[model samples]
Target chain A: MKLLEYQAKQRFAAAGIPVPPGRLARTPEEAAAAARELGRIAVKAQVPIGGRGKAGGIAVVDTPEEAQREAARILAMDIRGYPVRSVWCETGLSIDAELYLGITLDRDRRRLVIIFSAAGGMEIEQVAEEAPERIAKLWPDPFAGPQPFEIRRLAFAGLKHAPELHDRVPKLVSSLVGLTSRLYEVATSLDALTCEINPLVLTPEGNLVAADGKLEIDENADSRHKDIAEELARDETGDDGRSGDDPFEVEARKRGLTYVHLDGDIGCIGNGAGLTMNTLDLVKQHGGEPADFLDIGGGANAERVHNALEMVLLDPKVRGVFINIFGGITRGDEVARGIIAARDELHITKPLVVRMTGTMEEEGRKLLEEAGIVPAKTATGAAETIVQLTRAGSA
Target chain B: MSVLVDRSSRVLIQGITGREGSFHTAQMRAFGTNIVAGVSPGKGGTDQEGVPIFDTVADAVAATGADVSGIFVPPAFAADAIMESAAAGIELTVCITELIPVQDMIRAREFVIRSGHQLLGANCPGIVTPGQCKVGIIPNHINTPGPVGIVGRSGTLTYEVIQGLGQGGMGQTTSVGIGGDPVMGLSFPDVLQRFADDSETRAVVLIGEIGGSDEENAAAWIRGTGFDKPVVAFISGRTAPPGKRMGHAGAIISGNTGSAQSKLDALTAAGADIADTIEDVVRLTAVRLGTQPR
Candidate 1:
């Protein structure tokens, strides 16, 4: 669950981290009111995605009238796929330097990592590649908070050339260390996957403030954080209880099925995660674009299979459906019955190529043949057939 | 002759009274796994499926001498269950539950490794020795005892590879699913090293997906260690879009990292035969093992 910038900044400020005073404005009037409250302001488009600054979603204005104009302009624009619903009017700061500070779990290393760089305002990956030496990484003891010395070493390296800023750097580093510890606690308590503060700016007054913030909590941990979950639900769905959510995905989740919407014409459904991924790969390899990734999981009956098919057919882009199920604990015959039932009920006109192997596959194939759908003998053959069928249909 | 669990290994099922636990316990017992006892908190002194029940792993171990634990507990309690099993000095613990918080797993992993007990997965299919012993939920009927060894980060896809091998008359010595979680007990190289030492295992089939650097690390290990056995590899999620989680929590492509193509290239460059599909895995395994493909 990705948090909007306003939410992230709110969390950051509440954790005792210094942030530019900001208020979320939903309209031009609200923007003007906020601008009046905070003289010089930065009207930032409140969206979940990055590159908002480069996309012209952020506007710096000196007066209330200018702030309202900028807010109206940003609100009318779209960044990536999301519409700019609101703008964050924040007090514009006089920054001396832009630095980076982020705490994220390194999935490969299986440890908590803190990334700090003197060179900020660009993607961390680019900084890592272009000037690796400027960035300092520290793997802090998760059980024991990061020591002051460890924090100082990374922070001092960024401000090493300036002898005048040496005294303030330690204070800044200590404060950052304190902020990071609190941030880690918040992340652990909420089971957040990442907490990032990019371009943590340094002011001439020797103050460090977070200019931008991003927090992504794990969806699986949402149940444990009910308030956060409810908050996100309200924000995403709006008060009217409807948004740009895919109906198929919403229905699939309700039915306890795993479904991901994707672009392309081939609807791929398989029994397991590995097999489903392999099915999608094979489909694309055979020149078919996979419309979605769906895993029906183990032991599916007629009703579940019907649900799976209906979800696939719900996507207008899907010209063909590929059901590549390798039944181990899942019985193939039952799956076949579900597919046929869904096909009949939904009045599906799209082509479906199935490759049902293992555990009573013959019975499943017999049922498919009876329904005038020929099952492929091999996984590769099924993938190829689906691609060909979709191409033929398009032609 | 098998890696990890064998016929003589006494097995205890955690969360035995739960729906998934009860079903898999029967399946494991049916496949000739030594059913010693079960552990479900507050359900001790009772029996489920003729296996004696204990409230804790320590009690179960004391009574049944069960050295291996197959966890079927819910995600919330999975970490504690793993730690409990490790504290009891169980030699091998296989966790079938998925979606345990990564933070919890890190702590649990540290404890398990410190205790010298191996943890397989928070989300995994467990290990199986064809016609010998079955631990978790991999369907036992598809396997046959032979020379080829299989290790994977997936459940049913590994099963598919095993089935393909069986269909092509290439039976397996042992097949291990290292689990799909980002943090797991044993990795591809860990299982690969064990397979290398086991004489019953001749050729190996490695199934990897587009996530983590496990496959690349396994390849590097293979190259460095100079393992002589033939290894065939199959990497899934070649078509997976970047930043999309593909069912498994750990199986996602972030930026330029954890791509299937990168994993495949690394494995191939390290001298592992790349199997384009499950059927291709069968053919490659047969060729590597000096067996005629059916």
Candidate 2:
């Protein structure tokens, strides 16, 4: 979940961190109203991804009319594959100096690091690439919090031009650290996979602002976080009432087999997440749009296998079903039982392509053969079979 | 003969009352693990699958003399669980739960380090020494005890590698899934050091994915230490695009250096025997062990 710049700033403000006054707007009228409130303002496109400014998503405007015009252009444009939904109207700040502040997970050290730099408004990646020396990074004690000494050093190195902001730097750093820690708590509580805030800005008026933010709550943790679930449900689409088919698609997800419903006819079910994704890629390579991705899990018992097949069959868009299982813990024989059961129980009228490998593969194949089902030798063969079956079934 | 766990290791389950914890606990016990006790704060006096339940990990350890703990506590209480285990003098702690906050993990990690206890995962599959003790939720039926030692980041990918090895008739001595969280308790270097020193282990199968410098660090250690045993490596998520973090928090490759290709190159440069496919990995590992591929 990526929060736009204004959303992040709002969170920062809530956390007792000072941020420039800003409001988000979708239409020109809203933009005009925001500009009137802020006076001289910066109209920026609100998108989840970074590099919005370089992509012409941000523009400075003096009046409400100018702000509205810039907002209209930004909201209409698409930057970096994300469609612009709205723009942010923020008060223009006097530049005594620009500095960058951020807190992100440092995996290697197994700690949360606070990064600061005098060079602000540029991509952190670029800053790290070009002039690594300018950036001052600190790992605060999780128990003790960020020390005043560390903040002083960072301020001296990053914001050397503004000695007046030196006393305020530690407070801001401590608050940001506190906010990040709280956000981490929220993320864990919600089962979020990731939450990030970038380009935390400092103004001449001794205020700190989070210029951009992103929060990606984990779907697995959705059951625990009602707020996230409600938000997601409110933005739901398709037959499954999700924002997209990917949420319901079990084949592509981390745990269990996920099959996403795409705008295609061929349905795909495979054993592992990695193998399933590769299978989907292979299907696309073979010029077939995969209707869904389904995995039967490592231990594909009769019930799980039956359920997987039933789910795919329920999708009315599916013309053909592709069953690909790499039997390990899940023996091929067990898979065959589920497939046979689903075939009998559901009256599966669609053509089916089956591929099985691993333990008891021969037994599985024999069972399938007895049921008049021929299994494909390779993943490609199975995909091709489904494409052919869909074409033949449609014709 | 192997590292971390074996048949004699007594296992205790924290958060044993939870669905995932109880489910995997049963699975672990069925796989011949010595599950002596369970701990769920309010669920004391109740028995789960005949294992005695206690109010806390300390009480469970005191009652059963269990040295190793596998935690199934939810993320919110994970740090507390770890601290309790550490304070209880548990020798080894394997947290099967994922999505623990980075800050919580940092504090927990510091506490563990200061207390002189070893922790395995905050978001990982637990360690297993085949035919002896299995502490985590890995599918046991796919594994068989042998002379090869295995370590990996991804749980299912590790299973794939192990299955491939099993198909080729090359069983494992011990297999460790070090978890894919960025702030994990154990790293490849820590596990590799154990494998290198273990007398029963003849060879190693290292399965790594894109993300983190652990693989690179392990490669450096292997090169510098000069472990005589053959190490067959397979790096998954090779075709995975750069800048996209995968399902695991520790599985993201941010810059050019963290990709599967780069990791593969580093491993290759360090004199590791590389395998492209699962089949190839097992086949090469068998050949190196002087056992014909099945």
Candidate 3:
């Protein structure tokens, strides 16, 4: 679960990471009041995902009236697919230099890496690509945490060109290292997957502050962090920050199923994550683009399957449906019942090629046969059938 | 002998009293796995499926002399469960749990590495030697004993590929699902190395999805060592768009790295036949082994 910028910054500040004071404003009046107190402020759209600045979701204003106007404008606008529900009105900063600093789990290395560069703000990746030498990376030991020397090394390497930043940069880097240590503490303690601070700024006052923050907690590890879970639950009740989630995805989550929308004609559903991905690949290999990726997961009951099918069929672009279930912990018979129920209740006329095998296969196949739904013999065969049926229909 | 588990694999299920643990435990027993004991805190002294339950992995290990552990614990306690398995001196530990925090796994992995025990997955389907022993959640009936050995990241994709192998008159010696999490206990290279050593595995089928450099590392190993076995490979998520987590949390294309095209190029460079489709796996396996496809 991704925390909104304000939420991330709040956690960072609580962890002793210096951050520009910010208040969340839901209305133009609230924005004006916040700007009045802060004097010069930046109104940032409170959306979970990024690219807000290019989308005109960010506005910098000096006057309270201008802040209110910008807040109203941002709130009424739509950036990408997300609606601006709230504005993060924070005191604007005058920076001596912008330095990029962040820590992310390098999935390939299976370790935490601290990424540092002189070129900060957004476009850190672009900097890494253009001038690789400017960026310095350090892999911190999970147990020992990031050491002061390592941070100084990375800071000196990345910001060597700026002679003015020599004395202050080391201090900033040390604070960042401490902040990173705190971030790691929160990550391990709260079961967070990622904690990042982009553009850790060196102010004209020679103080360091995290200009932006992003923290993503692992949703599966929610049981361990009750406070965070409660906060997330409370956030979900209101607009919070999840503004652009498709209603279908939300419904699927409620029903204990996984769904991802895609731009294709064939709807694909499978019993496992790997199988679901393979099903999508198979669909494409057989000359059909997948409409969505849906995993019913193990031990799914009739209702889950019914809901999964219903959600997939909701996509009008889905000309054909393919269900690839190799039931192990998930009983084949329950899946068969769900498919039959979905076919009857939803009145699904589109072609559905199901290949159900393992764990009560006979019973499941019998149910499908009785429903006049001829199941495919193999996964590839099922994909072939769905592709053929959809192509034939289109022709 | 199979690469990981066989009739001799004394299997113990961690979190055995839980829903997934109990369910797959029963499946493993039915598939002829030597189910020796189970471990679930506070559920000790209780018996389920006629197997002994213990309070700790150490107790379970001491009582049953179990050498292999299959974990089905929740993500929060998954790292502890793995550490427990390793601490108990289990030779091999297979974790079926998913969504373990990367930091926890990093620590767990470091601990396990120090302990010198092999960990299979934090989100894998485990290993199965068809008609001999089955561990983890990979469906038991999807496979049968043969000369082909399989190693993969995704559970259901492995099952689908198993079915494809079967449909092509090829059966598996042992199919190991290393899991689709960012961090894995046993990686593609580890599994491939085991498969190469096993006499029963005349040919190996490698299944990988987008994300991570495990496949690339395995490819480099194959190229460096000039592995003798005819390894056939299939990479999923060719059409997967970047930034979308396709069911598996680990199966996402990030930037220029972790692309299907990149993995395919690496695998091809390492002298492995690529399967574009599920059916292509069988065809490539047949061609590599100098046999006619059924």
Candidate 4:
């Protein structure tokens, strides 16, 4: 799950990483109150995605009135696809320099890579592409954590380009080492796949503060951090990310099924993730756009299939559904039974062309034929059938 | 003559009494896998049907002389399960558990490497030697003993290709699922090398999804090593949007990398025949192997 800046700060503060004192404001009145408490403030949009600043979702205000006005503007604005439900009101930092520090999985090395760069703030990716050498990295041992010397080395390497900070290297490296250690603690403890403190703000006062924070927890390891997950879910102001998602996707999440809403009429379902994706590809290959990507997963019995059928047809745009099942642990006959039961019980009128094979597939085909549903001999043949059926039905 | 498991390989189940474990265990037994002892911690000295249950992997290994372990532990303990299998001296550990923490796998993978044992997946359908032995949960009936070898990242896509090949009258020597997690055991290169070593394996099918450098790495290995086996490759997620994970954790297009086009380009540059669909996979496999499709 991706946390908004304010939510990420909640974690950063808990981990003792310095973040400017901040409050979440759902309304302009709340923003004004926050501004009254903190003298010079920046009201930033609370959205899970980045590039919000460029999209005019952030504003600096000197007074409560200005804070209120900016907050009202940002809150009403929708950046990218995410509507700004809340704004983060926080005290402004004294200008000195911006440095980037983040930790993510280095899949090639199979280790947690800590990335540090003098080029910080929102455009770290651009900096990496242009300058490249400005970024320094360390792949720390999971058991031993980041060594002090390694972090110090990384900090200096990142600061090599900034000649102004060359004199302050001794003091800066120590602070960076401390900050990075805390970030590592947050990453390992929270099961964060992406834990970043972009624009590690260095003040004239000689302190490192996390100006902005980004934390994306590993979906696989989410069960271990139930408390954090619960806290994230409790925030109903949309940064929990469901508001940004399609209603169908949100519904799929509620139903505990893997579904991705697409812009098409062909509703595609398969037993596995790969097969589902391939089903979508095949739908397009046959000149039909896919409505959604749904994986019923292994051993998808009648009840699960019933739920999936109901869920897919919830979208009025879905003219037809193509359920491609090549059973491994998932039996073709079992899936056929589910499809038949769902179609009859729910009175589903949409076209369902099933391409069933493997593990009692003959029985599955027989059942589909008896039920008066289209039984396809091949996946491509099924895709062709579904597209033609849907197009003809619509015409 | 298969890559991992054969008829004589004794397979033990970790978390044998769990729902998935018990169900797949019955399936594996039905497929003629040598069912030995099982490990369920407190369930030691008990028997689930004919298979004996031991409290620990060490005890199970000692009793059954089991060299292969199929782990069905939950995500929380998946790493521990893999480590336990390694420490118990299992030659090949196949973990069917999904959602294992990457850090845990990083640690477990290190141990597995140091132990000199191969770990297949924390989220994968395990290895199957057709008409010989089965380790994890790939539907037993989709396969038959033949000269083709298969390796893939997705379970159902792998089954589709295997079934298609079978229907085309081309059976498989073994089908390896390296899994779809970003951090997984036994990558594409590892499985391809194993297939290269197996004499029964003729042409190989490489099934990949959008994610990581595993597919690219496989292509590089093939090019660099001068691997002689004819390779037919199929990559899914051609239309999947970036940053959105399509079911599998690894199937995401990040920034400019891990796209189907990139994987396909690399595989093509490496001289592997690329297939657009499951039907194409079978057709390409036949073309490469110089066999007439039935």
Which number leads on DockQ?
4
The estimated TM-scores of all candidates read: 0.92, 0.81, 0.93, 0.96
TM-score winner between candidates 1 and 3: 3
Question: Count of backbone clashes for each model?
Answer: 0, 14, 1, 0
DockQ winner between candidates 1 and 2: 1
All candidates: CA RMSD (Å): 2.9, 5.3, 2.6, 2.0
Q: Which ten residues in a row have the lowest lDDT in candidate 4 chain A?
A: A236-245
Candidate 4 positional error at A122, Å = 3.0
Residue-wise C-alpha lDDT for candidate 4, range B1-294, written one tens digit per residue: 788889989999998899888988999999999989899999899999899999999999998899999998888988998999999999999988877888888889888998999999878889899888999889888788899999999988888888899999999999999888888889999999988998879999999999788899999999999999999999999989888888887888989889999999999999999999888998989988889999
Worst 10 residues of 3 chain B by lDDT: B136-145
Q: Which clashing pairs does model 3 show?
A: A275-B157
Model 1 lDDT tens row, B105-220: 87788789889889998788889998878888887778998999999998889988888898899898899999888888899989999998899899999999998899999999
Highest TM-score against the true fold, candidate: 4
* DockQ-based class of model 4: medium
- Tens digits of per-residue lDDT, candidate 3, B66-116, equal 999999998879999999999999999998888787778888987788899
Across A1-395, the per-residue lDDT of candidate 1 in tens digits comes to 77788888888888788899998898999999998999999999877778999999999999999998999999898776677788999999898878888877887677778888767778888988988877887777656757767877767775564455667776777766776676676677767788888888889887888899988877667678777667766666222122345676666676777888898989999987899999998988888889999988766777888888888888888998999988755777999999999888788888889998765688999999999889998888999999998999999
Q: Which ranges of candidate 2 are over 4 A from the true structure?
A: A80-83, A159-395, B99-104, B243-246, B252-257
- lDDT-superior candidate, 1 or 4: 4
Fnat scores for every prediction: 0.63, 0.19, 0.76, 0.82
